[model samples]
Target: MGKHLESDGPSSFSRDTVKAIISQFLGFLLDAYDLTMILTIAPVLAVVLFPPSSSLLATFNVIFAYSLTIIFRPLGSAIFGHLGDKLGRRTDLIITVLGLGITSALTAALPTYAQVGILSYILFVIIRIGVGIFAGGEYAAGHPFAMEWTPYKWRGFISGLVQGGFSFGSMLTAAVLSLFISTFGVKGLETYAWRYLFLTTLIPAVIALAIRLSMKETPIFSDLKAQNKIRKSPFLDLFRKPYRRDFFQVMLFMTGLFFYSYSLFAFVPTILEHKPSVFSLSTANHIYTIGTVAAFFGAVLFGTLTQIVGRRRLALIWAVITFIVSIPMYYMLMYGASIGNVAIATIAVIIIGIIAQGPWGMIPIYLSERFKASMRSSGLGFGYSSGIFLGGWFSIYVPLMHEYLFKSIDTPTNVWFSTAVLLMIGAVIVGIGQYLGPETLGTRLSE
Candidate 1:
């Protein structure tokens, strides 16, 4: 038998164990905040980071930066996943957080295009790439580290709560952006207010770092180390026959998950900001904030459900729901400015949030359960980042399709229709994968 360490028992946790959990949750929360913050300010970035001489280029650049970060995340995932698996999750996590914190601060300090011309845009892309690199590892390391430390019975609950931390970040970004616009107006938001939002990333970074520093490595990983079960090359092993199936299955699920969720949260904001839009920028932000609240609860609910019904079943069910409702919901969001239409839009997005994020609640534990501690981080990180990398490429098509398919028509209809098609396609892919995937509820980490 492999060396086994005691799991964190149900009743109590040592102070350091508690600190580690908190840090992981916060790390996820902050990672979400940092990534979504760019989407939050896409409207402003279009204005401040690009000259008005060509609105099309400005719009493309905004999506480009967002897509670039998502696409580059795999590089970070592969590199850090290797390090986390070989060295230690805690050690690599600290390094990743430090990189993300520094990048956010530097991004806030960048000059606007009005002040520095195209060079400003170049700097922004560079910083976003840096963010992606660090971001790639935050959850890949954090999820396995946290799940491995918890009791098996509470795994679903803890996983849901921590994954919901992402929604918390999404909600926080909307709330903060609303506050900034209220204080500064649109012009000020474009000029100075946007910088302050990037600066806020530092808060969670500091909090996560402090907690991580105080904690010991997880009991599961420690036990593996004691037995010398750690692999010399976990990254390569992920592609070998034994682990390869789970690796690709998880990637497929995430490809669908990231594609729909990113389109809903990140791309829609730009569409709502278009002229003759049904919702004003402030109103859209409010709607997103509300939808994210629903998403958090949805995540928790599904996380809980997975324990009873099984992970594969719950994922398949939600995948079907997302596919069915995605298009109709888009039509509702594009509904005209009547109060009735706005109400429909609001309810539609809230439901979308629930369906879109529900399956993610089980993802952390599910992915963690698929591999042994010897290479869990590497396997999970590469799969997660690779799926996100591929899914993110869809964002480029959003603006391109809108500009081409419906250039003469309304922009909102164009975006909603385009993104809805993408979401449906993703849902179908995930549903097929989930049907063929294994169910791993109540499995112990060291199994």
Candidate 2:
């Protein structure tokens, strides 16, 4: 620590380090904000795209569209991850942010079913696909870029705080949605207010782009170029020998991370709204916002702990805690909602959010440290995004598994048990992955 401090100057966080962190945070925040806008208004969009009588199918369709974005992210990761490693982090990030900004603007202006029939839904799906590609590239480039700038001792703090942007962005969406609903009423949301939801991100997109423009190339990447060690194919390089093992292990851990995220943070609001006449939509949104708030802080706390306790130990502890508590934690959520105890349910959601999502705070640095600089950008981005291939589909699998297991979707019973099982499954994978992967707590970025 002292040696790194001496080399990096006395302070752990310099002005440039802070700027890099903030820039990447804002980029990630905007990414979440844009992607989540679809979910915030998914029910309404479903109605506009399909016949209201077929509410179930319409909802499923919108979800499929959303999932398409996840499934297609690897293409972006490969393409942008390659660019990032080959060209530089700053250039690749600028391209991604700009692509995202344009796609978001396109989504905001898309035609509705009333105007263009099936074409409307088709266009919306296409735009979401575009979003997935850009969003995939975003973390692939931005994560490594920012981590490369961080001082060794400060990695945990930077990782946790930067990753917290996802929750902050989701919460930001809830806040903006609430404001618009008040101003325009639910009627206004369906008519036109929803456009602003997508359009609103344009401002932040520009701001993030400006930040990327001002940023310098990461020192490690610059040095790689100076030494003529830039890999000819960064994405393909991950498949070679030693890095191949690191690639899959990180991918496994990340798959569990995505599963944990989708299971709790993504499913809660839907679960609350599905309960039998317990919470109003407004109350449910409030609960979601609170959970996200807790989740953001939880990530920072756990991430900070990872630095002290070691990543493998910290992750194993959480994995065990999650496994033992999954059933009870979910039961509390169901029990509180069923009994109309919003406080009980809200508290359950908060605890679940912290335990489940907090460990992600260590991801940026952990993944970066696992690979050398030559493959760092591609390895980090592709591995992180690759998890979506399996883990991302867990949300879809829960309902199917519930229907098969319970022999009844006749009620909300499926939610409590099925979700608990899936959450535990994901947590176990996390434990195994962390245990098997190398402990990287004290490693330098250039290691």
Which candidate ranks first by TM-score, i.e. highest?
Answer: 2
Which pairs of residues collide in candidate 1?
none
Compose the digit string of candidate 2's lDDT tens values, residues 1-447: 222332431136666777788888988888878766776567668766765655434665776678766787888998998988899898999999999888977887888888888899899889988888998899988998888888777778889989999888878977887787778877778887777777898987999888888888888888889999888987898998867988999889988888788776556766675645277656767777788888888888888888889888999899999989988887788778778888998898898888778988999888887888887878888999988999877647776766787425325433666777788988989998998897887666663
Give the TM-score comparing model 2 with the true structure, all chains together: 0.94
* C-alpha positional error of residue 229 in candidate 1 after TM-score superposition, expressed in Å: 0.7
Backbone clashes counted, model 1: 0
* CA RMSD (A), model 2: 2.2
Q: Count the backbone clashes (under 3 Å) in each candidate.
A: 0, 0
Best by lDDT: 2
Model 1, residue 120: distance off in Å is: 1.3
Model 1 C-alpha lDDT per residue in residues 1-447, reported as the tens digit of each score: 221223433334556556767877788888878767777677678888888855545666787887876778888888898888878889988998888888877878988888899999889889888888888888768888878777666777878888888888888888888898889987888878778878888888998898888778877787788888889899899999888988888888788888767767775665555545656778878877888888888888888888778888888878888888887877666663323355766787788778778788887888887777788888888888878757887767666667777555445433667777777878987898787677777566763
lDDT scores for all predictions? 0.77, 0.80
Position 376, candidate 2: lDDT: 80
Lowest lDDT sum, 10 consecutive residues, model 2, at: 1-10
